[model samples]
Target: MGLFEDLSRFLETRLDEFLKANPHLELWGLEDQLRGQEQDAIRLLGDLKRREKQLEDSILATAQDIQRWHSRIQQAQAANRIDLVKAAQEREATLLRQGNQYWGQLKGVKDQIMQTRTLQKDIHDRRRELKAKIAETQAQRTAQRTTTSWDTGWAKTSFDGFGRDPMDPLEESFQRWETEQELEELKRTMGK
Candidate 1:
C-alpha cells in the first residue's frame, strides 16, 4: 500500500481544488473521491489482518512441531537408543531453526500490522477533518448568500422615496427591538 501521508495529502489537494471551483455544486464528487480512498484503506487493512492471522497460525504450528520433536528425543533417550536420540536431537535442532525463522517472520508481520493500523487511523482522521472543513465552508457560503438575499428582500420591502415609515410608532419600536435582539443572539451563537 502507498504511504498514508501521500494519500491524505492527495485527498487534501483534491478537496482544495473542489473548494476553488464553482461553490454551488453539490460536493458529491469530492465525497465520492473520499469514499474511494477510504475503501482502499479498508482493503489494505483487511489484507494485513489476514497476513497477521496466517503468521500466527504458522508460529503455532512450528511450536507444536518443536514440542513433538522434544518428546521424541526424550523417548529415544529412555529406550537407550543413542543413535535414535542423536537423530532426534538433530531433528529438534532443525525444528528449532525453523521455529526461529517463523518467529522472525511473525515479528515482521507484526510490525507491518502496526504500521498499517497507524496509517488507517491517520487516513480516517484526515477524511473526517476534510469533510468537516467542506461542511463548514459550505455552511458559511450558504449563510452569506442567505444574508445577502434577506438584505435585498428587506430593502425592497421597506423603501420610500425620501424618508422611512413613521406611522406605527409602537409596532416599529417592537420590530426594531426584536430585530436587534435576534441579531445579538445570532452573533452570540456564532461566537462572532
Candidate 2:
C-alpha cells in the first residue's frame, strides 16, 4: 500500500480503538472538541480585531486632543491671558504625552493582530493541505486495489495454455523449452 493509504488505515484503526474505549459516549464528543478549539481561535481573533480598533480610535482621539490643546494655547497667548496660557501649555504637554503613548499602544496592538492573523492563516492552510493529501491517498489506494484484482484474475487464467494430459519426461522437457522460447519472444515483442 502507498504511504497515505497506510496512514489513513492507521488513523482508522486508532479511531476504532478510541470508539471502542468510549462506547458509552457519543461520537459528537470528538466533534465538540474540534469545534471548541476552532471557536476559541475565532474568539481570540475577534478580540484582537476589537482591541486593534479601540487602540486606533484612542490614537485618533489623542491626536485631536493635542491639536485642540495647541489651538487653545495660541488663543490664550493672543488674548494676553497669562494664567490661561500657562494652563494651555500644561494641557498641550499632557496631550502630547498621551498622543505618544496612544500611538505606541496602537502600533503594538496592530502588530499583535497581524501576528494572530498570520497564525490563523497558517493553521487554515495546513488543514486544507492535510485534507487534500488524505483524499489523494484514498484515490491511490482505490486504483491500487483495482489493479491488484486485475493482476490476480490474469494470473489465474494465464495457465490455460498448458494441457491437462500427463506427458512423457522427454515431452515435458520439450514443453518447458518451448515455453521459455515463447516467453523470450513475448519479452522481445514487449521491448522488455
Q: Pick the TM-score winner.
A: 1
* Residue pairs of candidate 2 with colliding backbone atoms: none
Tell me the TM-score of each prediction against the true structure.
0.57, 0.51
> Model 1: how far is 184 from its true place, Å?
49
Model 2: lDDT to the true structure: 0.72
**Total residue pair clashes for candidate 1:** 0
Off by over 4 Å in 2: 1-38, 133-192
In the range 59-170, model 1's lDDT, one tens digit per residue, is 7887898899899989989999999999988988988898788788878877887887787787677778777877887898878877885665433234345566444355
| lDDT (0 to 1) per candidate | 0.77, 0.72
Off by over 4 Å in 1: 1-19, 23-31, 147-192
TM-score of 2: 0.51
The residue pairs found clashing in candidate 1 are none
Number of the predicted model whose lDDT against the real structure is largest: 1
